[model samples]
Target chain A: MNNSEISEQGKLTIVGTGPGTDQLLAPAAKQALLEADSVIGYKTYVDLIRHILPESCDIQAYGMRQEVERSRAAAALALEGKKVCIVSGGDAGVFSIAGPVLEVISEEDLEKLNLSIIPGITSALSSAALLGAPLIHDFAVISLSDLLTPTELIEKRLSLAAEGDFVVVLYNPASKKRTELIKKCAQIMIEAGRKDTPVGIVRHGFRADQNVTVTTVSEMLNHDIDMNTTVVIGNSRTYRKGRFMVTPRGYAL
Target chain B: MNNSEISEQGKLTIVGTGPGTDQLLAPAAKQALLEADSVIGYKTYVDLIRHILPESCDIQAYGMRQEVERSRAAAALALEGKKVCIVSGGDAGVFSIAGPVLEVISEEDLEKLNLSIIPGITSALSSAALLGAPLIHDFAVISLSDLLTPTELIEKRLSLAAEGDFVVVLYNPASKKRTELIKKCAQIMIEAGRKDTPVGIVRHGFRADQNVTVTTVSEMLNHDIDMNTTVVIGNSRTYRKGRFMVTPRGYAL
Candidate 1:
């Protein structure tokens, strides 16, 4: 194996499963899971790939809001000379488990365990593909989950992204208890004079009950949005073409 | 076949090859290419997957700076009922061929040709994986190539992204003649109080001669940056840990 491959002594591989779809999962990520002695993740994300895990592979699935706990478990397993694979639903590097797992490893076992992060298809790009190419230019991805970040900061980002003419992708737009963040985000964008901008709302992308809608930013709040939804608000140049929403790359065609 | 699969007709499938690595390529994209009658892309990207293309598959590799011509060709080929696959080195939706191909088809043949876009690992996410999850928070992806976008707008986006505290990823950062854009972007970030932010520079990510460096934003310009490099500037919470650059997910560890 090359230098990029993990050595024999207890390695931790963080894999992104790519929108909970088997087909979207990268081959490298699949191989990591197949080779792992223990696979850990949130219960919902881990359930998505249970079919691919071997029977001998230990499946450690935790419930919601146990990110730190799962991360610590992953690091501890690797330190015990077990090849551990921690799974994240989308790309692990983007608002996912890689950071938390790395933080846990950095605390005490930085040298004993080998760490590798495998990239996956993030929701922004997957949603953009389903709605036509709305992120062809510069774009910003912000999560509306105020649990980690301040709501005011999220609002500021929405405003700035809109004013900069960025195609903005919003993850974790809303949850059951926090239903106002998406509405607030829409207000911030509209306040920045983006009321007419095209917005694509994709819920459970590439999964069962997947719904994709291309509408204007003004009408975005009228649709169904939840924690599973990914919202893409277009730049000034984005427009709807028949069933597709496209942002031109300014080619002189 | 599922509804997601194309019918037996002329179709255009835009595939993201994921940092030019076969292992990183998604199964959906690989399936699309394997079922394709003809494959077309920029010479560099096309050559990356040449080993996977069947001997009976017709290969059309175009030179650089021919995006419009290639998009038109892909659309024309699809209109004639040949399953054509256009490959992009990274995710096609991000500053690649998807938008151009969609735009070319939207002009007149929107209803005639079948189009499907399969997501892949973008350079930002792939480079972030190599750099140890520097993009675990909100991030902005901006391309420094001014071939299609105005320089002033690109500069404005960089400043806003920095001011908003987004981990910024720079794509197409510099070429032989376009060195000043990245330098200018560094100045903008520095002006926005990101001078000391952690910066990760990844060249030829997931490929031979891959180089990954973790440095501060102030020292980012001293690296060997070129068009093939992806630069990730960290947010205020990002820091270097041993060889890995990590942005915490605000989890109380």
Candidate 2:
């Protein structure tokens, strides 16, 4: 540890825990966890990897409503020279804590501590892999969560993805309060292009009880999907051959 | 081993060798190779994991034009119930021997040779991770090699990626015969959007001689980039703030 490392006694590494399994966590991520002094994350997420955490480690658990409080707690812990790991499901750098952690670090103590992000198996790529090759071409990832952004803004992204012939992956697709967003997304995609376009439903992808089903945009709108489900809607060239879903890597000449 | 183990013999688990390092290779991929009866890949790639490959296992080498022939040889070995590991750099599924071997697997010999593609880090993702955060939003990945697709089709995809506000990653951007395609790509991106958009030329992204530079779309046209480089053209949100190249993930929502 150099001057920068020593001055900032408390360091932070935000990690993506991967999809509900230890086997999926990258080796670097596993090593980082062992080096941490304190671990912080939502209680549900914390529970998933509690067994691996060291006996001397302190855990700061947060609930659904206490976002600010949780961030503050983690920050204060880091300021005290504790090695902190901000845990998030999937890759931390995505829709997870990467932004928030970076935000608090810059504002609170960038000069005092070290901060790095460890990439893990992002759910979008994981889902695409499990359901054949929907992401072999260009793709778009959008969060259906309207908690921060308005529903209108999400629609704009969907329109852009559809018009560009980009494969689209929906995250936070159908929370209890946001159930209608996924349906609205399907309607917009249908308006932009083909209704018969292939749609893949991978609920709990790479996790226990992982459900994979393929349907078209038309049929999917009528089907029930939940927050756990990651919906992959294929571009114009996407097709289904028997049980395998295939997305061409553009037509080879 | 038991009768079940004997029947499952000559198994082939094709693993991605990562872009070019030992640490980047997944633990599962390492395990698969240790368990393999024979490992086959391009001679160069096999050398990376030379220490781990068992002396008892047969090692086969193939050169540039010999990939198809190598796949056939590996599949034939798998048919005899040998645990075959056909290696490719980066993810086995992405433009590698994984799909080719799957295409060659005989339905009759399916039981004898179980083919599983163990994912390794893909070059696009590996490069993106190294160069700040080009993959923070929707993106397009296009290979400039016109061997399979026409140059015109590749150009069309480039246009679409720029128009769609994708942080495009250009692989095989330049080769001996095709020197100016990267410049042409920069020109199209400039026409599609703001000329000042940041473009990153990352050579050997995760290797020892890693060189990363951020230049505008206009500068990239004249900038020297080679086949070893992965060019990242930022979307609308890409900006140059001092020494670092950034593709902001919507700047704090």
The backbone clash count of each candidate, in order, is 1, 5
- Which digits, one per residue and each the tens of the lDDT, describe model 1 over residues A1-253? 5653445479899999998888899999999999999999999889999999999999999998898999999998898789999999989889999888888776458877788899999999899989988989999999999998888998889888988999999999888899887888888888888899899999888998789999998999889888889999999989988778999999988
Q: List the residue pairs that clash in candidate 2.
A: A8-A112, A10-A81, B9-B81, B10-B81, B10-B82
Give me the runs in candidate 2 sitting further than 4 Å from their true place: A1-9, A64-80, A107-112, A148-160, A188-197, A222-224, A235-242, A248-253, B1-10, B65-71, B103-113, B221-224, B239-253
Q: What is the lDDT of candidate 1?
A: 0.89
Q: Residue-wise lDDT of candidate 1 within B70-173, one digit each (tens)?
A: 99888888888899999899999999899888887765687777788998899999999999978888899999999889999999999899889999999999
Query: Model 2, residue A125: what's the lDDT?
Result: 59
**Candidate 1 — which residues are off by over 4 angstroms?**
A1-8, B1-8
Alpha-carbon lDDT, every model: 0.89, 0.71
Task: Give the Å shift of residue B17 in candidate 1.
Answer: 1.0
Residue pairs with colliding backbones in model 1 are B10-B81
Interface RMSD (Å), every candidate: 1.1, 4.0
Sorted into a CAPRI-style docking class, model 2 comes out as: acceptable
Task: Identify the leading candidate in terms of lDDT.
Answer: 1
